[model samples]
Target: MTSPHDAWLAEAVDAARECAHDESPASLEGAATRLRIHASLERRRGSSKRRLTVISAIVASMFGSTAFAYFTGWRPFAPATEPARPTAAPAIEHEAPPRARTGPGPSVPVEPPPLAPAAPPGEPAPPVLAAPPAAAPPRATVGPPARRPRVLPEPAVRAAAPLSPATTPAPGPDAELAAYQQAHDAHFKGGDPAAALAAWDRYLAQYPSGELAPEARYDRALVLVKLARWSEARAALAPFASAPVGAYRQREAARILAAIRDR
Candidate 1:
């Protein structure tokens, strides 16, 4: 048989061995579970940090873009100013003057009589009575329609008056004789036979009873003879030849007559 101390030591030793086996498995399982938990927590923390960094960068980029846009005059949220509208100037209108009242100064507007109600169909309408012609305006003093004033002739325009002195004497015999002598000079001195004939004829017609009348006949007969007018020369010289025997041109007229008859 063994002692009691030896038996107690064996029991204690068995108990200690059993406790070590159970504690080692439990500690190992607890440590492995703690490592798995710690790994999951670390993965979650890393994802959260990356997401926060990305979010912060995106926010910073958006703020920078907005500030750049504001500085460069490219603002996205600034209110715009509308252009000013031009105001129109008021118009000045001038009113015209009222016209003069013609046609008898707006006579009392006579209201027409009201019409009767319509008669049955097919009945002839009654004729409207005409107004009297308003007394013909008092005949207007009519007065011969205003005779156009007569245009009397002016005193200066009537028969013209003589322009010379009333008392001027008539031309004398000597003056008349001088005119005849001047005409006679035109015949011989001017050497124009037709002009000489015209001069002699004028003297004879104007002064048939003058002292130069016979001389005018004598010279006119001579001019007719020079022009080959034999019949006129004969007729002209006949009167002078038959004149009184002592007449101024009687002998010359007879000589001219004889010369014409010879031709």
Candidate 2:
């Protein structure tokens, strides 16, 4: 149950909001002023118990109501409007105009031929002919069909991707060391002369002239002697024990050879 004053205030607020859209500066200013007053009144509404505040809010409300009404076209004191001027003939009537056509000033609109009168009662009505279906528009070729992407031949790709078809070369120093270390471990640490022999053979096959080949050859001969493969031992030891190139394990190789020959 809102009071009449609340309803009037609501209408004033609505009128102010409507006036906010007016293109005129005066209406916009009046809307802004009324809105500010409304905001102040809302803020002091709960404080209506204070006499001074209520008096001021009421005065502001009166001013806002007058403003809202005046801006919203509620004018009891508006000046009488003057009579409107008569519409004059067009300016072209005063001047000689250029000829529109060689013959006529303006063409009259043609009326459609009157439809045939309805058939007399009980006679059959004429059949209406329908327009034919429109032809489908031709499909335009936007351009030549998009060229299919060229697929790479698998064989050609394989050929291009691979490096030159050169044979794998000999093992590197690190690989040589790794192979020799494996044989050495099998021989000394595991005490398996047969496994050592296989590892040595693998190392020698891959790295015949590798960095550790001299050492590997000497060790392999000892390993063959341990295995009692006399012929292979003789063949293996003879190369290093006889010449003892670089004196690498020379004494060891010679001692092993003499012992094997004695055996």
Provide the overall lDDT of each model, using Cα atoms, as 2-decimal numbers. 0.75, 0.77
> In model 1, what is the error at residue 40, expressed in angstroms?
99
lDDT tens digits, residue span 1-263, model 2: 99746875887878776786776888877777877877777667646647777798999999999999988988679778998989997777466775333332344445555566788999998865555555555544344357899998776433445555695655667877888888889988877899999998998898888888888888888788889998889888776676746576666777777887866
Q: Residue 188's C-alpha lDDT in candidate 2?
A: 87
TM-score of 2: 0.35
lDDT of 1: 0.75
The C-alpha TM-scores of every prediction are 0.34, 0.35
Model 1 C-alpha lDDT per residue in residues 28-107, reported as the tens digit of each score = 57655655665676678779989999999999999999899888978458678998998988988988986544344334
Spell out the clash pairs found in candidate 2.
none
